[model samples]
Every structure is written in structure tokens, then in C-alpha cells.
Target chain A: MRGEAPRGAPNRLDLHDLSLFAGWDPGGRWRLFGEFELGEALVVREGRLRTDQREFDYERLYAEYDLRPDLKLRLGKFLTPVGRWNLIHADPLVWTTRRPLTTELPFAAHASGLSLLGEGAWHGGVFDYQLFVDDSLALDPDRGDRPLAGGAGMGLHDSFDHALGGRLHLLSADARDGLGASLAWFRRRGEAADRLLLGGDWHRRRGRLVLDSEAFYRFGRSADDWGGFLQAVARIHGGLHLVGRYEYIRSADLGAEGGAGLLGLTWRFHRAGVVKLGFQESAGPRVQPDGWILSYGLLY
Target chain B: MARGAYRSQVGLWSWPILAVLLMGISGGALAAAPGIAVVVHDPALAAGLDRASLARIYRRWQRIDTAGRPLVPVNLPADAPLRRAFTQALFRQSPEDMRGFWDERYFQGVSPPTVLASPEAVERFVRRTPGALGYLPDCRTPPDLVVALRLRWPRAAGIDPFGLCQEGD
Candidate 1:
């Protein structure tokens, strides 16, 4: 599948991926995968609100590769290997709103990277582990104007920054009748500022019930202090999801706590799409006294 | 004397009728299919798999085998009765729900298992593949395959609109 390229299309780049996955038995080693997606969004980053009116992003690229039964390595930009929600994307999640004040504040959600992932079992349960490294662009500096505990300015400092992180996950053999937990960490070293992050999530689902919670702590020595946040999500029915969160931040120069309470609903229109709506109330020294947000999201 | 006669006569007919009804019920119960076998590739696996373990393997949870081979699960064609039986006994979710489940995994960079055309194909594939696993009807013993678990349709029946497997037998 790799050799087909549209000729005379010099500006059109040809990209492909080959992945081979096998079970313990030889017969399960069939190769499968291919797809391409075009994504675009427009964002107006001004004042307190960041709105995307028109923009284009390559949300996914189709490719293939398969070698060695026991290991598989993917080469391309994939979703950032971070918390549960970020890894799974927006569609399959139970909650309507993106994780509140805490979950979205810390990490970049997607990156171009090489991912090495494997799964096996030990101690009578299933285990999945992954290690990945990526080259990423720094966050736009103008996006870092929030009042953090330790005054840290956010923006691009250099061009050649990179990040590395991994996750160790454990689940019971039964997907619906098991517990899943993971630990992840990442760091980016830019010419002017460096950033470090550590985070994890604990999740459980049984029958119609689901529970998931995650925490992240970020530190960098560039301009301000260290900050982190914790977010939790619970699903009672397939339709209604409840969320709660807390955030604590310590600047290199100052120490304070920033926190919020979030209650939300994520209604799945179908498995591929969903509608999310929520309310957030902040409670902390450095929080928006009357800050509330409304958002709509989609995944396809 | 009259009261005693009336009581005796009522008891005589009631016992005879009840006995006949009980016998008829027992006959019908005995005629039903015996316990169904959950077939796999390794005969020894029959000893290790419980309802929970078998459920996990079918759901693509425990993908690796005890011997370190990755476990690939094969399914019958979308309309097979045996496939319905296996999925009903295992996932409790409908085929549509199962597709949605796999879609989530796919977007997350996980691939779903390959689907085979028939039970014969599954048996042939599993026999050749070391870590491949699939289920078939318990009627015949195919060569080179194992029986992993036994499943009985629950007595308390409900139309599982979502095709989710009932929990814990």
C-alpha cells in the first residue's frame, strides 16, 4: 500500500504507515489499517476568550507498517500520550464538556511523535505500556497571560524544542469489569524556557457504570512557578456524566492554591459524536471570581 | 363418613394430576440441549478459563496467552447464530455497540480483531495459529482445538436490545 503516489503533485507529500499486530498465536498476525482526515478550525485568541472560527489541522493521517510479532512502532504525529481523555479524544468520552479548569490547563494535547506501545499480562491481569518522544512547537506566548501563582509568562522561546513521555497502564482481563490506572510524564526544553509535566489517571467501568479521575503537575524554571491540577469524572448512565476538579499552583517565587468545581453532561448522539455542556465555579485566591464558560466539541 | 369420603376423593385426583404434570415438565427440561461448550485452540486452556477469563479474551481484553503469544479472537460472520450465542454470552452488548466500542479503540490507535467468514474458517484459523482463539457449538469435537468454557442461556430471559451480555451467570 505504500508505493501509490499521485504523480505531478510535487506540493502533495506522500506519507504512509505500516503496522503489524499479532496475538499469542501465529494466525492472528494479520495486518490492517488505513485512513485520512482533514481538519480545520479558526481561532481568535484575543482578551479572555479563545474562539476558533476557521482553521485547518491534519487530525489524522493514514499509514501502515508491520514487522516483528511482539512489537509495533508507529511513526507520525498522533494524539499526545497524556491523560485518559486526551488520549481517547472527544467523541468516546462520557462527559460533555472538556475536563474543566484543571484537566486542560497543563499539557499540549497532540504532537508529532514516534510511539512504541505493547500489551501483555502479569499478576493475573492485563497490562499495557507505551513510550514515546516527539518534536513539538512551543505554545504561543500570548496564550500565557492568566494570573498563575508564580508569575510565569507563556510563549515561544526557541524553535527546536522536543518532548518525551510514557505511560504504564494496568487493567483487569475484562475491559468492562476491570480497573485501569496509568502514570505519564513529559518535558520540553526550549532555547529560552524549559517545561516539565507529570500526570496520571485511575479509571474503572462495570456494566453501565464508569468512573475516571486524573491529576497533573507542571513545573518550569523559565518565568514563574510550578502548577498542577486534578480532575475526576463519573458516569452513572451512559448519557449523564458528572465531573469535579481542584487545582493547586506553587510558583518558583510564590505559593498558592487555585481550584474549581465542575458539573457537566455529555450526551452521546451516536458513538461517533456527542454534545457536552457544563458549568464551572472557581474557588481560590487566584481564580476568576465570576468565571464561567460554555463550549461545544466534536470528534469524528 | 361423608366428609372423609369427600376429602379422600379430592386427594386421589389431585395427586395423580400433579404427578403427570411433574413428569411432563421433567421430560421437556431433559430434552433441552445439554451444557454448551466454549471452544478454543488449546485443550489445556479449558482448565484455566473461567467465565470471567473467557469473557475478557472474547472482549479483546486479555490479548496475550499464558505462553506469551498474543491472543487473537475471531468472530463468525455478522449473521451467524453461533456468533450471536457467543457475543450474547460474552459482551452483553449488541453488535452495533461492539462496533462503537472498537471505534473508540481504533481512534485511540488500537485495532480491532479480524472477523472470519464462518465457524469452519475460525476453527481452521485457530488450529493453525498458536495464540488465536474462537468459539463454536458444543455438538462436535473438531480436531486440534480445545473447549475453554461452558455457557448456558440464562433462565431469566430479557431481550438485550443493546446486546450486552448478562453479568456473572
Candidate 2:
């Protein structure tokens, strides 16, 4: 439900996503979860579909075993242990349909490997932690941002270059309030380039108000880039909410600086459906064409 | 002229009659609202829990207790009216909002609590399991059931439309 400038050529509706989420739990010893999406894009040249392309993507397909109530072992492809947005970016979960580039502009978002996830009580709160190591192929970062599933998202990896990462989360005892930090290191084949990233996130929800934000910085041999977003949502009434978001990015590598302020209102009038309208204004040199979105989305 | 006067009299009296009928329906609904009780297998494990702890337990966001015991929260069937009342009283969330929350959590490799066949089944499960916690529609208090908390109906119903259930209350 996002339209760009001049003619709204690359309008978001040019693509469609048919998605499914399923899970099975057997007596608490083991659990299974899968999220799949089939995307069809117009493959347009001007305003017409020159050809159509189809892709089936498995965003998450993993089996987890609870070795302990506070800890679990999971094997398969999962969202990288990075930031809040990556884990909860699905259309039905996020506050806005428009995504911030900071979340996806660098590094592939998926990791295929074994992960150790654990949580325990701490003081007046709890701290959750995850460590991941993967040597799997990733869809290029830019492609993963679009709705078009870039490749057969379900796969095995033959290339043996490994990256290790982890995230630590400390939250209030209730788990509604928290802070998180993440870091990852990856040096591609023969030390051709070294890439490292650091990120932090915070979220708090009280009564009718919710606030969450995340920041990410990538350090490279030659150029450094950083980006972040801050957002809040206030529930005004039953199933009605007002939301505001600010997104910023500075890329020395791409020599680009940009930001956008977005405000939206949503009416969750239906059980699983919402109608949302949002307006965004761009800032900086890139002149991100100001736009508005009116759309309906559902979880089911 | 007498027939016209009689029709006017019926119209004038019908408003109060309808009001009385509506009051009856509402009163019946309120009286029928199911009372809810937090039940645990062991009475000793009930301490350190309040509304916040209750919400997290049912949400499956927190799966352990204060003393680090693995807590397994059971629930009644999804469509049970009593279950709706319990969810409303605790989470202040509609059934659909909950389904969506569970779906999102599933993709995160987190599973929701188990749904037992009936509230009686939930009561029985909590009795059999060491670290089990659950809710029942009434405070009947089965032979082995321990009621950690109980809420009178109507007032305890999702009366607080916002998500935060009064924590200590």
C-alpha cells in the first residue's frame, strides 16, 4: 500500500504475497514451526507486466527442542540474531507497511545454522540470549527487502564460509519492557572483505502506549554506515491506534543520507483485519518522494 | 374515537415495557458471566504471582516460575465462552488478537500453551502436573485444585479494555 512519486510506478501492489504459518508441538519435548510465502510480481517494464515471475520462500523452517524450560536448541534457517525488526517484520505484526532501510540495507537477514537460545530470571527482570553460527548462502541484502522471493528460499548450502553472531536481551520482570544488544562478524572468502555490525534495541509498553526503537551500525574496511528508527503507537480506543515513526540512515559507502517521518492511524475493525492510512515525508539529499498509503491487511 | 385513544395508550406504555425487557436481558448476561480462578497444582507455588505474571504465563512469553520451576499453563478450548471471558479478564485482548500473537510467536520458534479439552480437563491436568498452572470458569475448588486467585464476574470481565490487567489486583 505504498505509492512512490510522479506516477506510483513501483507501487507496492505490483507484488502479492501468499503466506502461511504453521506449528506443531508434541508433548513439549520438541516443537516445529514454518513460515512460507509465495510471491508473484508483475516484472513490469513501464506500467505493464512484461512477464511474470514466481518464487516460493521459506522464511523460517526450524525444529526446536527444549532441553530446559529456559533454554532451547534450534536447527534450520532463522532470522539472524540481530534486531527487533528482523524478528517481527511480518506484514501483520509491524506497525507500518513501509519498512525502514536500516533494518535491511546491509547483511542478509537469514541465518542457517544451529542456535542456542536461553532465558533466565535476573533481578527484577529476565535476560534472554541467543548465539548463532551459520555458513549458508543468503539472498543479497537488497533483494530480501522486496516482496519478490529472490530464489528457492528453501535450500542447503555448499559454500563453507561461516559467520557467528548473538543477541542479549534484558527486560522487565513482566517482559513488556526491555533492552537488547547484538553483534556479528563475517569475513568473506580469503579475507576479501571483513564486515562487522553492532546493534541495540529498546521497547516499552504501558497501558495504551508502546515505544520501540533500534539502531544498527556497520563497520567496513573502507566505509562505515549507520541507521536507526524510533516509533511509538498509542491506542486511542478499541482497536484504533495512532502511530508515528522516524527513520534515518547515513551511508559512507553509498554516500547517501536520508530519513523519513511517518504518521499513521489504524482501525483494527475486524477480528483479523486492519485498515491503515499513513503519510511519510522524506528528508536529506535523496528527496524520498513524500507519499501516503491506504491499505487493508490481515494476519489470517 | 375510543379505539384511537386505546392505540395511543399502548404506544405510550410500550417504551417502558421495552426498557424493562432490555434490562432483563442485560441483567441475565451479567449474572451468567463466568467467574474465573487461577489454579495451580500446588498451593505453595502461587506466591510471587500477580496480574503481570498471569498475563505472561498465558501468553507463553514466560514459561518458568519465580523459583525456576518449569511452568506449563493449560487452557480451555479456543472457542469456549468461559475461555473468552478468562482471556478478556487477563489479557484484555480479543480472540483474534490472540490468534495473531500466537502466529507471530510461532514463527519466532515460540509455542503457545496447550489447550486442554475442557476446564475440567484443565483442572485435572493442573492437579496431576507438578508445575502446572491454569484457570477455571468457577472457584469450585476440586479436591486437589488450589485456587491462587479468584475474580468475581462482570467486574472481572475484560472491563479494562486496555491490555494491562491490574497487576496486583
- The backbone clash count of each candidate, in order, is 38, 0
Q: List the candidate 2 regions with Cα displacement exceeding 4 Å.
A: A1-12, A41-51, A138-161, A187-192, A284-290, B1-57, B61-72, B76-103, B109-111, B114-121, B124-133, B136-139, B145-169
| Cα deviation of A12, candidate 1, in Å | 34
**TM-score of each candidate structure, all chains considered together:** 0.58, 0.69
For candidate 2, give fnat to 2 decimals: 0.15
lDDT per residue (tens digit) for residues B1-169 in model 1:
9999999999998998999999989887655444346666666566667765666566554555555455667887756655665666565544654665676665655656678986668778888876667776555436556777767643322333122222212
In terms of TM-score, the best-performing candidate is: 2
- How accurate locally, in lDDT, is each candidate? 0.52, 0.69
Task: Give a tens-digit lDDT track for model 1, residues A167-221.
Answer: 7777653344333343334443323455666766677665555556666566656
Clashing pairs in 2: none
Can you give the lDDT of residue A200 in candidate 1? 66
Give fnat for candidates 1, 2 and onward, in order.
Answer: 0.07, 0.15
Candidate 2 residue-wise lDDT, B50-159, digit = tens: 76567667767666665556678887777765677777667554554466567667557576788898766887799899889888655344656787876554343444
Residues A141-236 of candidate 2: C-alpha lDDT, one tens digit per residue: 322233212213222121214578899988775446879999988643333466798999999887788898999998978888788989999999
